[model samples]
Target chain A: MKTRYHIRPRHNIRPQSCIYALLASISVAVFSLPNAAHAAGTLAGTDIQNVASATFDTAAGPVTIQSNTVTIKVDELLDVTVSSTDPGDVITSPGQTSNVQRFRVSNTGNGDEAFALTATVANGGDDFDPSLQQIVIDANGNGVFDAGVDVVYTAGVNEPVIAPDQNITVFVITSTPAGVVDTNRANVSIVAAAVTGTGAPGTSFANAGQGGGNAVVGPTGAQSSASGFLAVQATSVTLNKTATILDPFGGNRPVPGAIVTYSLVATVAGTGLLNNLVITDPIPVGSQYQPASLTLEATALTDAADADAGNFNGTRISVAAGNVPAGQTRTVTFKVLIP
Target chain B: MKLIIRIMMAFATLTGASLAVAATPLQLSSDVFVERTIEGVDGTKTVVLEKPKMVTPGDSLVFVVKYKNVSATTATNFVVTNPLPPAVAFNGTSDGQEIVSIDGGKNWGFLGDLRVAKEDGATRAAQRSDVTHIKWNLNQPLTAGAEGKLIFRGVVK
Candidate 1:
């Protein structure tokens, strides 16, 4: 039997197999697509270049990190400029004197960042009122002074956002009172956010921000009130002899015609007021009293209120007998002619 | 097998729809902190300029306070209350300034107008010392990382 079996064509297609292949392919595609997108969009670590850093030189040197991340860099420079102009072009006048000071702040940063600016009246004597002063912000970052751009003034508070490489102006004015001294100074500081990098130029890798610059007010009137409390203080008091003849022979060698001068000094302390006060130093029993010629000399005397007891004029007084009010304890410099 | 393929396609489509619905990006970092510092004084606590280290009688002092927004979302309906310490007097302007009695932690308005009967059957109006606290109402919202400061003055003893 020559059996030539009829070769039937095998239908190899299976619905389940097709489905499994399709599902596996779809999963692979979905996972791979995201990986590719992330690789394309994500910034590489090397792309960020920390340029420079700035440090805040405060009364206390470098400040410790208050937070984990530092906010200021040392490489960055902040320019704080101030200018004042009296409305009438004359700073001194009798009428309503309005002086406007313009403060310009600019940041030289490589990236777009926000900065905090703080303006303070530095060591302003009792005369200046920080509360009365006005502070305006030009939100547009323009250097010009414009109406309606006035920002509310708050002492010791940081101003609004300052964009990088941009400038902002702050105006300060004072109304001078009659016969009052109009002197004031302002300090402006820019607190830059911290950047990255070590040993880099201005790279403040530490996230702690830093401050810079001091601005001062221009010319004004004098202080009006003399009622300010005065405290006199002194570092130290010292006594010195201008001329001392050293006796090489050792004994109390009283050389003939040799004159000895005794001087007593009362130093004024910086903390208190030494008003028309009198000072007297008693002569020791061993020292002889020279009544003929008694002289008083003072290094500094601002007013004519000081007067010697006996003499109407403040110069010198003659010592007659019992403790002289003017010459009792004062520094007595006399020429005691040796016998 | 065909059913399995169909199920896989459906799952992918569902995931796609969900992703589309939830595709909001993280706009800000978590570390931003907006802060404000205010300078002011409470009653009884006399802060002197010369000897700021100690509080004394008949002394003028300054009070400083700081406010910060630490939340990820904006903070709204903010209120701060500070009480006048005993033996302290408020300076010139008191507008927008309130007095409180609840130890400076709670808010109170004028206490002089309100009278409460005591156990002795006597009615007494609140005095300055009875002020529970002072409050500042900021109706505006504070955005994330925003800060502010406030200041005031007071005289002691």
Candidate 2:
């Protein structure tokens, strides 16, 4: 956008004096122009700042117009985090460290960043420590720790630069002590700090402002710590079956076709929270589980599989007992017809 | 058929535009952060919530809106509309009444001014549940290098 001014070239009026006033007024006019519409401008959040330059071929000379240069700067927010799905917190058996618990560290920052990785034991709970700790990156992104496939993550220097919103899956490999019991528990944690803008691994920042302008202890949200418990525990669900025979002549006898009621008592005994408890009981070879005779704790349930919470398919009865706490029992009773 | 196809293309373009309009960059992102002061037998200690996966009743949390001048130029006419989470209710004007929006962003006033219609065909005082959304009129320009949080305390419903 260019603005041309005609000066009439008055002999009495000084060219310097007139041009200064004219340029000042033009600057004000350009700035004071009614701001962008609510939908087009701030309301809709579509606004960009840029310095402008104007030149006027007047009696003076081709002069360049200058204003404050608005340098666009965005906040470099770093948010590194680690989360694990150790739902049951099951303990590792002796000579059995194969139970791999996966922990993910993500760089939820605006720019690419390298984070300092560290794993430590947090003391607070009745937990045991892993005899040996190993950290491995999920090479194939399959969330599984394949010994030969996935490579071990070396500490310090050469740490991978995780992009914003990108995360890498990590396996908290642990080995139990020689003597392991059911009552033993262990806790392990992983921490990651931003190494971006910092020269080396041990570089630390003080009074650093995060993305939201909040002064955090670390460099930014760039640092996070997550601890997972590896407890020694197991859940046991007991099922007891019972049957009652009814004959065609109203007599209790096993004939060609008769109804036999079966009762299954499911009990859970464990130290941790058990989840996704799906109980399945297959029908005997001589009889079939009746569809409509299913009752859970005296509550009638649909016979078809997936018909209700408790489903009895053609060959078996399957029920989803979700989140069965420790020392609790669930009873499911249904009838089967002897064919 | 040609006319119908042209109209359909126009409709699709307009729909896409309307959806994109809501996610403009200058828009402020808001989230809930819960913190409580636990009164223990020893003393009182304030614990900052980290990844709040579960919350109990009677617990109060801070609802903050992070505003930034995402655009190259200064962002004027800044106003943030933060909805109270379904499980939480507005406690009061937390920042000394400097930020008050008890009425679905219609008018800025005190809690007493906010009202709701009752079953008796009469207008009555609005309850905590009636606080559908909270609005803050920044009355300031968000220039570059400007980032801040507008916060209010909310109690679990």
Candidate 3:
């Protein structure tokens, strides 16, 4: 929002009279005050005026006196705050690439300011150090990482300019090594500082703030940093199979014209997610595969590769058990007839 | 009978007589300052007032109003009224005789005796931000060439 000032013409009129006229005109000007809910408090360059008057009774009559108007301009404050938004240690498998750690940087000052952002994975408090890639901003602000959609950060080029009490979401992308151990953690941190300058609290930069006013460092010192963690987890999926048979007019034995039912169970173990896991079972050499007898956890599956999870390709039965997390299990069953 | 013949709020002009010698008997001036606490080497702190060249929100300010009687006669029933700026909030004053108005000079009383209406149609105690104007009634008469000051405090919003 633009701030408008109504300055009265100052010519032959005295300074007091000019101020009075300016104050009167100011009430009519469309002045858009900064949002009151903003943590930055108030906008810079706001003019505050005060005037007083006295009335007295004299022997001749009653007289009223008007005081000179006093005005003061509000200066700009420089402050920034950064924090990690990750719910917990981001779980990733070994040799995983494109791992991301989310963070948010906020401009907590009373003026518009630019910030220079930097990310590093050289922090030594973790088990393994993940190779740091480039930092990217959530351009759409959806909090999810999208390659080719998010903008990459470059120092001195396209630094984020944030308004007072506004924030931007940033992602620190990294790649874990292939030989890393399970349950290991790596730390990556990002630091954001005001592009104008940074120093001890109360430090002032002349005419470097919005509206050409002096900028003062606030309690934050105009810089802030936050760290996010990435953890490595190992995972594997195992499948077990069992078969049952029944004859036409006798006990359960592998006889001619006997119907055989096969069951396969796939169980995932470890603290990581097993991606694109699939289970397959082949029919016996002397038996004919039954049609429409394939079932996944008691759910029927068609022979064609349709939208369902299980499908048959004339040679074997395949079930796509996509992304199985740790401590989870999946079951698939099919049937065949003895020739 | 003691009758107030005329009351003028403008530049105090007189007509139909010796207009050349027409000047108000009282002079009023206003000034604002920012206060800073300076710590000495002996662990002592002193508050110093300085002209505000650079002020920001949440900063404390002091306003001073000076009035003097410049005529040979005396000024009686003197009352000083100050309208608080929109960008500032009234902090308490050291003077105990000040009266405040919450509703645009419609009602006046001590802060403790004032009540403001809330949006829920209920009345609640008035706070400092509710103050719109401050007034001080000087019952004592000002003799010739006598000057005094009224000081109050405020914080930039």
* Top DockQ prediction, candidate number: 3
Q: For model 1, how does the per-residue alpha-carbon lDDT over A150-253 read when each residue is reduced to its tens digit? A: 56545446544443334455555433334332222222222222121112222223222221111111011100101111111212223332323323354345
- lDDT per residue for candidate 2 within A1-339, as digits (tens), equals 233321110011011234333422332233223221111011000011112112223233332222122211122344567787567674666556655777888865444567677777544675566654677778788887899898777878457677556788887787776565567777777877776443222232432322212111223345777877776765556666667788777877878678888788778785655678877788889887776887777788887666477886577887777788879877787777778
As for lDDT, the candidate ahead, 1 or 3, is 3
lDDT of 3 by residue, A1-339 (tens): 211111111111112344334432332121213223446755555567776767777787666666776877667888999999999999877898989899999999877799999998889878888888889998888998899999999889989988777899999899998988678898898999999889998898997876557888989999999999998899867888898897887668888988888989999887877788889888778888899998877889898899998888888999987888889998888889997
- Looking at model 3, residue A190 earns an lDDT score of 93
Could you arrange the candidates by lDDT from highest to lowest?
3, 2, 1
Error of model 1, residue A277, in angstroms: 46
User: If you score just chain A, what TM-score does every candidate get?
Assistant: 0.28, 0.45, 0.64
True contacts kept of each: 0.00, 0.00, 0.65
Instruction: Say which docking band candidate 1 falls in.
Output: incorrect
What digit string (tens of lDDT, one per residue) describes model 2 on residues B111-151? 66767666678988766545645555566666765777666
Task: Give the winner by DockQ: 1 or 2.
Answer: 2
Return the clash pairs for model 2, or none: A49-B73, A78-A222, A91-A231, A91-A232, A128-A185, A238-A267, A240-A265
Worst 10 residues of 1 chain A by lDDT: A42-51
Cα distance off (Å), candidate 1, residue A27: 39
